[model samples]
Target chain A: MKEIYLDNNATTKVDEAVFEEMRPYFCELYGNPSSMHFFGGQVQGKVTEARGRVATLLGASPEEIVFTACGTESDNAAIRSALEVFPERRHVITSRVEHPAVLTQCRNLTQRGYRVTEIGVDGTGRLDMEELQAAVDDDTAIVSLMWANNETGVIFPVEEAAALAKSKGALFHSDAVQAVGKLPINMADSRIDMLSLSGHKLHAPKGIGVLYLRKGTPFRPFLVGGHQERSRRAGTENAAAIIALGKACELAGQHMDAENTTVKALRDRLQDALMRIIPHARINGGGAERLPNTTSIAFEFVEGEAILMLLSELGICASSGSACTSGSLEPSHVLRAMGVPFTCAHGSIRFSLSRYTTEAEIETVIREMPPIITRLRQMSPFGREFLKEQS
Target chain B: MWDYTPIVKDHFLNPRNVGDIPDADAVGEVGSLACGDALKLYLKLDESKDKIVDAKFQTFGCASAIASSSALTEMVKGKNLDEALAISNQDIADFLGGLPEEKMHCSVMGQEALEVAIAKYRGHEAPVHSHDHDHGPAYPDQEGTVVCKCFGITDVFLKKVIETNRLTTPEQVTHFTKAGGGCGGCIPKIKELIDEVMGARPEEPRKRPEKLSNMKKMQLIQEVLERDVRPLLWADGGDLELIDIDGSKVQVAFRKACAGCASSGNTARMVEIKLRDLVAEDIVVEEVPA
Candidate 1:
């Protein structure tokens, strides 16, 4: 079956070029970067080169980039370090629509005796900037926010939020896992003190990420042990994946605009088709300035799981509801925060296209989705009565 | 996605009966589209014989909805009025193997429509009693706390679920009674009740090296996790210890990853399946965080 993968927000396929660049390091150049030997020195060179590449992508100095295991680890490191650096500062402000990597960590911090103020987002999934400003106080340690929402692809004014945090004498950290490759993010002009990015969200392999900590930030190490990452992160370097990340970052810098244009067109086409063909269908994350490649639609009378299963049968891979999360009982917190009705929450489908997504695939989904939705809705007692009620 | 049984999937894809009767003797509709699911049933009654002649339905919602409608139609067709009324969600699920308990209400909706339609055939209003048995309080309980939003089951209903379905795990309670199935807030409650119910049952002496099939082994694992393992983890702010069986030993892990966790042995005692718990004596429970 010709599988059409549309769950880019969850994770992405490794680019062939990135994979090829990484293959040699895993085998021939498999040396511990920390070792004093020449074999290791060569690996260290590659790590330095990878760091430079990742730094270049964000317009940051190579010395400031600290590679970690993943975005979650980077986030944990940033939040934990911020809290430790300013223990007396009990107040922390953040938006409600952050990924669990930030949300759970904040919640954990709250339980550990810190007063964390979570600001809610508007119906369009935009943060309340005024409310955010009101929440931040002189005692605030940090204002941690995400660059782009993983679920809705909604972008936040990271620079503006960072400036607000800075004005309040607090540091700012943005989880840029979803934004680094897709959007134009410049670390130099931005007031962001710390930013997290994952390689998997780009074309690189998993288990490798970069955290850009501004040169003069009051940061402490979350992982303690090795002198790796300049004593910032303590772990042996994932030399191969890091090398792949560098290549992925280089490629992202070049193809970013072209991919955005192509993917946006495809996304718009898919969204238009779904709205036209399916009754009571609307984009859940509409009216927000979202990433060009993503679209989330709610099929009013159908279950999200059923829609996904049908799509799967046709080799069309996608995600839906809270069902997308393994064993999770709650729907997407981002959607819920935006006040998406529960009636449509469990029935929302996110179609996240990539740079590789084709017009043919978009056309196919447009053709297939309407019928799949219609069939599921037909099976729905809710849809039947809804139509009855309408009539 | 909810782990739907193959039978449920099959029944959903190739539903037994669908579409509305052109001239139905009676029609029944329940639930609203606003509620996220609805069912409309049409029936042709052979009044002289006091039996159902033809049945069909139009459903709006998930796979379970369509399957339930189809199953209801099959259950009623060619059956006497009393026999049709006697058909329960369990019967429909049994007819189609089994359905995920969260989806058991889908079948229950069919049963509800059937009752309403039968009452309509009798030329009387099917009094909208609060007790919508298929997903409502199946067991009489004056004081049991209500759990399972999808099914509205209680502690007594859970006990009946344990006894009737021979449910030995939290998953089974969820499947049978729809408890601990939605939002999963009541999973611990379901697990607790399973232990209490099993404790109430007379203990059978341990069977030595009993040859068990894969299905039996899965049942054991489910029971062990629900009755024995889940509650311990629940108390610790954690849950699912393992996904399924791996070779001989029952593979287990932690739900939310245990706080200050260094050992997996504490989680082993939580498994309810007697066989797996007994097997734990010989086999080591390996805990790996994924």
Candidate 2:
């Protein structure tokens, strides 16, 4: 069975162009960027060019980008620095549906005498702006919100939310990991003070991430070692990944239209067909404006892992919002925050498409998915009860 | 994706006896959707009612859970009712090659269902066990302390698994029985259980001298940290350093992997308890974040 990879939101395959660009950096141009020699100087110029390309993608100056390990590190660096710089402040604000990188860290901060306010989301996964407005106050040190949710691909009002945070004299940060390549962002308009992005989510390799610290955002070093990243971040940069990220970003500029059109159509087609064929199937966050490539479906009375396993057998790879898939007892925080019922939450599957997802693959999934649900339902005890109720 | 054995995959993909039997002599149900897994089992007895001629199940759960339920029905087919009732969770795991430790609860669910099924066959109303604390070995419903609030695991179950399995680490205890897999307020208690069960050394119970100087107390605390705590932690790619001594309250920084380790709460308790046993009974240890 040929693999149909629709779990792109988890991690993308590195583009051939991006890989080729990074190839030279590994063996040929292995000079230390911090070194003074002509050999190192040449390599440093390439890195600087890479930085400019990333900056161009976000519509920001090169000086604003600070490279870090990954999206989590970027988020940590940004949030930790903000709290440290404003020692008098003791409160933080974020949405309940944020990725664990933001949510767990903020929750952990509560133990250190920091009060965190997690703004609620509606059934459609849209942030409640009134609640967010009420949550932000003078004592708030930083407000961290995700530009887009990875699970539902629901876009939050980052620009509006960031502005609200800044009104109360709080530093605003957005983890734009899922949004960077998918959405056209202009940091020059500048409501966002810090934005964290990862390489892997946008067809670049992992091990490299960027924290766009809009210049003069009271920075404190997270990984303090050598004077790398202008002493804002320390330790040596992942040179190959940084170079690959630049190429990926430059390509992302060209591919945004296809992502919003062709990839989005594939997602919509798959979602519409599955919902039509399978009874009691529903879409999560269907009411909101979602990313072009993501669709989350809940197959009622069926287990997500069982559905995923059946899908895996046919080489249709995707992720689950199910707790069993994560080895935890609770389903996804995003679904729970949106008040998705227990019947649906444990059985949710996320199909996040990419530019590479073909129309034929979507058709195959549409054809294959209905029978799998029917088969699982036939074996399920609750499915029988649910069917009787429906009848 | 949980690295389930090939047999588990097979049982899951082609689960046996999937539907309920119409003329089942006994029906047993366990778990709930809120708990993330549930099983409904039906046992049809032969003419004598001594042996199960056929068995079937209906499950609402993950792959491992469905597989475990399916596996149980297959294992009990054409078996004596007493023999079927005797099969344990470990037997189910062994029948399916093996299950992941994290998914061990699924097998436990199967055991609970089978036990209830047999009880029903014998006309005894089985005790109800839900996903919450009511189902644990030692909870409010039972005799011992409910150690892990997250998974509703009890100290009695913790101690039993430790002695039965000859377990050493707190991580192992969570694996065999989900005792400390929760908010971890009970981790210190788990560490103490492991210490009491595994470290069965005759304690001298160091008697305190009257009117010891502050300097002497600090030295004793430092001596214990260097001698006892740091070495045990260093063996596990973890280390700690004593920061300050505020009378009986000792502040320390957990360094290396132990600094932000999930088990550090238990590890910290292990240190405090060990210090009290070695240094002073009233000595309290707190981690000052590094």
Candidate 3:
């Protein structure tokens, strides 16, 4: 059966070009980038080239890009470094809809004498700018927020939020893991003090991430071991994945226009078709500016896992914010923060598309999802009640 | 994703006796939208109302919750009312092989709804006790000192689970009862309840230092509040205030978001424990009604 993978925000399939770019490093170019021999020296030059390519994608200088294990590590390094630099500042501001990478780190900070102000979102999953404004006090060490929410696909005004943080004398960091390739980001023009992006989200392999520190930001190393990444993130570099990321970044730059055009249109086609076919299904972040190739649709009175299970049998893949779907006791925090009704929250499904996402796959989803929802709704008690109410 | 047993997946996919019985003799419902799961069970009873002749359920929850409800309806169909009441959450889970540790509440919901249906049939009504077995004759006025705020688990319930299951440790309590699973703010309280139940050490005169200096006393109170109470309150967008201490009576206040919460008294008592553990035994925390 043909497979349809629509959960790109969770992680994407690595591009074949990027994979081929990384193949040699695991075998022939196995020498360390820090080594003195010719084989190793050549690898070091390629690694530096990779850094330049990644930097180019983010509109940053190569010197400012610090490579870490993954996006979580980058987020950790940024938040921890901000705190280490400004020990006297105990307040940290972040939106309530951040991915666990930033949210969990901010939560951990609260236990260590840091006060966190999680700015709530509006009904459409848009951040309340005024609330975020009031949260960024002078005592705030940093304001960390996501560029785009992973669950809702809602885009945050990171530039405006970063500027607001800067005005309050607080460092600003954006976990741009989901937004890096799907959305246009020029760290050079923005007030973002630090920005994080993962390789995996941009069709690169996992195990590599970049923390772009706008030059002259307060510096502290979370992993203080080797002189790698200019001692900013200390460890032996993930040579292969870093090379893959470089290649992926280049491909992402080429596909960036396609993301807003073909990919966006494909997503829209799939969304509109699904919504048209399935009555009472609404988009979670449809009212706000969202990622071009992503849509989170909620089919009321139905559980997401059941829909996903039925979809899986038909070679369609997606994910849900439902408590049962996430293996958690509550629905997605993004949905809860947006005050999504319990009926919709329990059935929220995020369909994230990437360059690899084909119209055929989307068509497959459009064809397969309605029946799944109908089947699950037939089984759902709320669905029955809804039908009763309709009648 | 939860590694649900095949039986559970089977029950979830092809649930038995689904839909409502509108003209049913009795109905039992439990859980809510806010709690992320709910179940409505309808039972058709024999003329004697002593035997459950047929059963059906309508559930809004995850796969396991739906499956658990479906499994429950199937399990209790042929049994008498009393035998059905004897069926526990574990039985519902056991019927479906087993549920994930986190998904056990779904099973608990099934059992509570069954009890409620039985109660409805018997001409006595009570608020849904799906959260735990703390309601009814189990505790006077269906009231128990709530220890785990995340799952609405009461101290009475914890003690009962421990006594019945011979459980030790908060982790075991979470596994068997799901008390301190979410947020984990109630874990220290869960530990204390376990300690209280096991008779490991008396609440008073077990861990307090013999004599603490005035400097040490002040430092301890501040540290405990800062280290423990403040973070917990702050997590929920609330702030705590230490106003005045007169002898052993510590006057505390909740500020910002948590000011007028009904649970402020319970929160104050939690603060009182911190004060008692750190400084002295007879430290009473009176919330200054702010």
Candidate 4:
């Protein structure tokens, strides 16, 4: 079976070019970038070039990018550094829809006597700016929010949010793990003090991430030991993955136009066809500005895991916000925080496309999805009643 | 990702019976859209109304849930009401080779629907339809106080699952019945219920061996503490570390929530009782301040 991989937000395939760029680092060019020898000096030059590429993608200086293990580490470093930098400030603010990388860390801060406020989102998964504005006060050390929601694909007004945090003299951070490659981001033009991005979310291999700290932001190290990463992060450089990520970011910059146009058209066509063919369904973040490559559809009267399993049979990969899929007894916090009703919350499926997603793949999903919904609905008691009423 | 057995996949992909019997002799429904899974089981009995001649199901849930429902309908087709009533959740899981531990609640839902169907047919109680969505008990006809408000599960329902499955921890209860899986506010209550159910079981007295090396006795005590006692404490966010053992007396120190608790004495006594029953009749548990 030819796999139609659409779960890109979860992770993306490593581009072949990016893989080839990193291949030599493992064998022939395997030298510690920090070693004193000339062999190492040559590796260091490539690493510097990679850093420049990544910096160009984000409109940041090479000095601002500190590579870490993954997005979670970058997020932890960003928020914990802000808290350490402003120890007297005892409050943190975030949104209910933030990825767990930020949300869980902010929540854990509460146990250490820090007040954490999670601003809610509206029905369309749009961040409640008013709630955020009220939550940001003099005592707030930092306000960490996501640039885009992973499940709903809803884009937040993060630059405006950073401005709100700045007015209160609070440091601002954004977990741009989902938005960095999908959307255009220029740190030089923004008030976001710290931003985190994962390599794997942008078609690089895993195990590499970047924390962009604005040049003049007061900061502290989350991991402190070696002089690696200018002592901001203390670990041996993940040179190969870093080089791969740099190449991926450069490619992402080149593909940004097609990502916004071609990929967006594919996402829109898939969303529109599913909505038209399948009754009793709604797009989760339809009213909000969303990432061009993502769509979350909620099919009523059926569970998401069941839909996903049937889709899996056809080698069509996707993801869900359903409780059962995640091994939890409650629907996703993202949907719940958005005030999505229980009826649809338990049945939301997320389809995230990438540059690799072909037009035929989208068409195949459109053809196979409705019958799967129809089959599951026919087997559902609530769906049966609804079908009866419709007939 | 679930490690679903091949049989489970077979059943999920090609479910045995997947519709309704409009003239069903009894209709049993459990769970709701809010709960993330639901099953509407319909049974058609023979002319004598003793044996189930036909069984069909309509389910709204994940793969394991649909497979369990389909397995239940197939298993109950030729069985009489009493025979069907004898089927446990484990029996349903075993029919499908086995379901993942986290997916056990799907099997429990199947068993509950079967019991509800038979109970309704026998006029034991009124049928509670899930479509009402009142957030009331999933099995309102079965009597008990509502313990897990999130899933509308009652103490009666919980105790039955715990006792039948021999479940010791709150996590198992959640996996089996979805109680204490949401918000987790009722977790302490669930721990208490587990204690009550496990305590109600009859303990058989074991004849103590006449002679044992001191090392062996100490090892036995530690094994019992690790296997039997710590889980119960861990469920309540508390734990005990064995400090030392001198002959029959075991010195222990409470940790976490158990430390400095006013009820530490009662907890110590309970530990002593457990050690006495499981190891030796004269074992003593002494709590030392942490």
- Number of the top candidate by DockQ? 4
Of models 1 and 4, which has the larger lDDT?
Answer: 4
3 or 4, greater by TM-score: 4
Q: What would the TM-scores of all predictions be?
A: 0.77, 0.82, 0.81, 0.87
Model 1 TM-score on chain A: 0.97
Listed in order, the DockQ scores are 0.25, 0.38, 0.31, 0.64
Interface RMSD of 4: 0.6
Lowest lDDT sum, 10 consecutive residues, model 2 chain A, at A379-388
Determine the iRMS, in angstroms, of model 3.
Answer: 2.1
lDDT of 2 by residue, A1-391 (tens): 6899989999999999999999998888998888999988887888899999999999999999898889999999889999999999999999999999999999999999899999999999999999999989999999999999999999999999998998998999999999999999999987899999999999999888999989778888888888998999888777888889999999999999998988888888899888888899889999999999999999988889889999999999999998889876668889989999877998899999999899899999999998888788777778888777777
Sorted on lDDT, highest at the top, how do the candidates line up?
4, 2, 3, 1
Error of 4 at B176 (Å): 0.8
Score residue B280 of candidate 2 by CA lDDT.
79
Instruction: Tell me the tens digit of each residue's lDDT in model 2 across B11-93.
Output: 99999989989889988886555546678899999899888889999998889999999999998988888768656566687
User: Per-residue alpha-carbon lDDT of model 4 for A204-293, expressed as tens digits?
Assistant: 999999999999999898888899988899988888998999899999999999999999999999999999999999999899999999
Clashes of each: 23, 0, 0, 0
lDDT of 1 by residue, B1-290 (tens): 56777866776778766677778888887654433456788888785858788888887556666776877788788988886876655667656666665566566566767777777778777233354333333322213556655445556546754643456788766544445655677788777877876656436754434666667666765665565455555444355546557656666655433523554455454343343445433444555553
Chain B, TM-score, each prediction?
A: 0.48, 0.56, 0.59, 0.68
Candidate 1, superposed: residue stretches over 4 Å from native: A322-329, A386-391, B1-6, B21-61, B64-290
Candidate 2 clash figure, as a count: 0
Q: Which model scores highest in lDDT?
A: 4
Whole-model lDDT values for every prediction: 0.76, 0.85, 0.81, 0.90
Residue A361, candidate 1: how far off, in angstroms? 1.2
Ranking by TM-score: 4, 2, 3, 1
Question: Per model, how much of the real contact set is kept?
Answer: 0.49, 0.62, 0.53, 0.87
